[model samples]
Target chain A: MKANEVPQDKSSLDSINQKELCYATDESGNYITTKSSGWTPKTIALNNAIEDIKERAEEAKQRVLNNETSPIEYYMELNRMDVTILAGYVGIWPFRVKRHFNPKRFKKLSDKLLQKYADAFNISLKQLKQGDLNED
Target chain B: MKIDFKHHQSAHCENGVVSNLMKHNGLNISEPMIFGIGSGLIYCYIPFLKVNHGPAVTYRVMPGLIFKRFAKRIGVTFKREKFKSVAKAKQRLDENLKNNNPVGLQVGIYHLLYLPDHYRFHFNAHNIVVYGKEGNNYLVSDPVIETVATLDEKQMEKARFAKGPFAPNGQIYYPISFPKESDIPYKEAIVKGIKQTCRDMLAPIPIVGVKGIRMVAKLIKKWPKKKGIKVANHYLGQIVRMQEEIGTGGGGFRYIFAAFLQESSAILNNEKLMELSKEMTVIGDLWRDFALEASRLYKNRKATTGSYDKVSEMLFELADKEEVFFKTLKKAIK
Candidate 1:
C-alpha cells in the first residue's frame, strides 16, 4: 500500500499494453494516477483467471479431437460458456443442447439450428463445423 | 465527425465516463469525487440471483445511477434514452456525433474488442463514450482502457443489444447544460456525499451494507461443511473476482472512497478527515489481504477446510473495523 510498493519502474508496468489507469494514494498520502504494472497483485489474480479459461479451452479442444464431443462443445468452452448459457444464446432447451453435444447429433442438426449456434458463437457455419477457434 | 473529447483511463467504468463527460462539458472533477457524490459504493449478496451460475455478489450500485446522481447533485441537465431498435439507436448516436456532441453509452463488456480476452465476460453494464464515427467504426472512449479506441459499427450494435441480466437496450446519455464551476457548492456536496455513504455502509439490511459483509463471512465459515470444498472454493473465487477483477479500483471501492476522503480533507481543511482517509487505506489493504488469502486457498488443492475458517475470520474482523469507521465518519463531519 506504500507508494514505494507500487513499482516505480515504468518497464515493469508495461509488460502488457494495459490501458486502464488506477487512482491510488501515494506514500505521502497524495492521490495520483498510474497504469497497472502487470506485476500488481490484482493483475496477477486476473492472469490466473485468464489462465484457467485457456486451460478449459485447451481441454475442450482435446475432447473434440478425440471425438468425445462435438465442435460446438469446444466453441462453448472457448467462449467461457456452459450448456445453460449456450442454450440461452441459441434459444434452445439445455437438455436438447446436451443431446446435440454428440458429434452425430450435431451433424444432423438443421441449418436453422446450426445457424443459431454459429450466430451465438459469432462465427460462420463452415467455421463452426470445422472447429475453427481463431478470434474474429 | 470527431468531437473534441479527451479520454482518460479510470479504475471503474461509470465513474470514468462521468468524469470524462463532465470534463468535456467544461466541468473538471476527479473520478473519485464523482463516484462519491453519486453514492456509488455498495455491498449486496443475493443467494437466489445468479450471475454466470453463481450467487450474485456486487460491490457497487447498479450501473448508470452514478451518472444520474452526480448530474443531479451538480445541477447539470442531461438527456437519457434507451432505444427499442438498434438501427434507431445508431442513427441517434450518429446524429449526436455529427453535431459535435460526445455521447455516453452503456454496453456489454463481452463484445468490446479492446478488452483482453480474459477480462471479457457477459457483464452488460459497462460504460463508454462514442464521440465520433469514422467510416464503419465508431471512435470510442472506454474508461477502463488507456487510450481511445474504435469499434466496428456492426459490432457496436451487437454489444448494445447484448442480452442477459442488465442488458443495455441501446442506452445513451449526454449532458445538455452544466452549471458554472464557480457557482457549485463543494463543501455542501462533499458533506452530503459523505453522509449518504455512511448510511449505505451502516444500514441495517441483512443482505446489504455492513450486514451483508457479515452474512458473507458467515457463509464462508460454513461453506465447506455445507457445500463441500469444491463448491465453497468456487464461491470464494467469485468473491475475489468481484473484489479485484471487475474494475473495483481495488479493495472493492475502498481505495476510491479513501481518495475521496483525502480530497474532502483538503476542501474542508479538516485534519481529522485526512487521518480517516489513511485509516480507510489501511482497511483497503486488509481487504486486499483477504482477497490474497482466498485466492491462495483456491489455487492450492491440498489446502484444508480450516483455511476457509481463517478467511471467514478475516472478513468478520474487516466488517467490525468498517462498522466503527463509518460510525466515526458520520460524527466527524458534524
Candidate 2:
C-alpha cells in the first residue's frame, strides 16, 4: 500500500493536531486519556509507517553498532530521505524567520539527528570522539 | 659565543638547532610556551656574512623523540621581529641575569608544533643564541643536526651532542625567561588555540533511531548519580555555546562526546543525557540557518544565543511527532 493510502484513525490524528503543542501534555500523550478501544485502519496505517521508519532506522543503526559504517555518513543518508518529507514544512509557508525556525520542532530534529548518529555508532554523545573506532 | 656556520646555499641545515646561536651571544633566552610542547626548531639572527662559510647563517632543528618529523620543519629567516625588541629584552635580560647570573649567553625559548611527514606531529623548543660577529658580518651559530631526541644523554648522543658545559648545544647564560609564571603573549596564543580546538570538539548535535535511543538509555543509566544536574547542564550549554562560537553548525558535539567518554562517570550525571539530547535536537535543526546568520553578522555582534524562539518552535514539532509515534508504545505498556 502507498504511504498516505494506508488507513489511520482520523479522530486520533486530529486530536493531536488540535493541541497547540505536542509535548505540552508532558508525560501523557493526547490519546492517553481516551479509551484503548479506538483501534482503526487509519491508526494501524500510521503505526505501520512509524514502525517502518523505526525498523529501518534500527537496522541501519545496528549496522553502525556492528561497525559497518560511519555515523556522519549514515546521518547524511537519513537527511537525504527526510529532506523530501520536510520540504513542505520548510518550503510551503511564506519565508519568514519565525516560520523557518520552529524551536520546538528544531529540537526534535536535532535530537533525531543525534539519535541516529548515536544509535548507529552505539555510543552516547559523551563517548563519541572525532575518530572513535567501530568494528564492521 | 656566537657560532656561525658557512655552508653551501643548497645544503639544508636544521633551523631548529640553529636558533640556539643567539644564545651563544649575551642575549637572554625565554622559553617559547607554544612551540616547546612538540618538536622544536632553533631560529637565529646573523649580524654579518662570511664569504668562506657556506650560508650566511644556520638554524638548529631539535626534534622531539615522539615527533621527529616536526623537528625538521623549523626554518631560519632574517626577520628582526622574531627578536623581542633587542634593547627591551636586553634590559630585562640584564636585570634578570644580574640576579640569576646565567652561565652563558641569554636566549629566547619558543615552543612549536610541526608536521614533517604525513600523519606525524611533533613539538619542540626553539631558542635564540648568538655566535660571532666580524666586521658587520657576525658568524652566527647554526643548526648542524637535523633532529635531536630528548634532554636525556642517550638521545642527546643520537642527535650528536657536542661536548661542553652548556646544556647539549649551549649553556643558559641567565635563567631564560621560562613561561612558567610570566604573562608571555606567545604563550597566551598557543593556549588559546589549544583550548579552542578542544572546546570545538566537545559540543553536541542530534542523532536519531532505536540504537541511538538504546545508547542514550545506556548512557542515562550509566551516568553517575552523585553529581548534581550541573554536569549534564554544562554539556548542554557547551553544545549551544560551541555552535555560537564556532559558527559551524554543531561543531562542539564531538568534543563533548570525547570529554564524556574520557572523563570518569563520577563527574557526569543522568540529567545530562536528557538535557543534552534535547538541546542537541533544537540546535541541529536551526544550525544551518543559524550559522549563516552568524556568518553575516560582525564577529562582535554574533551572539551565541541567537533566536531561541525558532528553536522552541522546532522542539515543539519534534515533541508532537514523537508523541504521535510513541503514544501507542507508552499506552501498550500502561
Q: Pick the candidate with the highest TM-score.
A: 1
Error of 2 at A43 (Å): 46
lDDT of 1 by residue, B101-216 (tens): 99999998899877776667788899999999888989999887777889998889978887666779899999998778888878888888889888988998998878999999
- TM-score of candidate 2 versus the correct structure, residues matched by position: 0.15
lDDT by residue for model 2 (A1-136), tens: 1112212323332432321100111132110111111113223322333343445555655655565544443332232223222222223222331232332332334554444445433356533333233322
Give residue B261's lDDT in candidate 1 (0 to 100). Answer: 90
Local distance difference test, each candidate = 0.80, 0.27
lDDT of 1 at B223: 80
lDDT of 1: 0.80
Task: Tell me the TM-score for chain B of model 1.
Answer: 0.97
Best by DockQ: 1
TM per candidate comes to 0.88, 0.15
lDDT of 2 at A87: 27
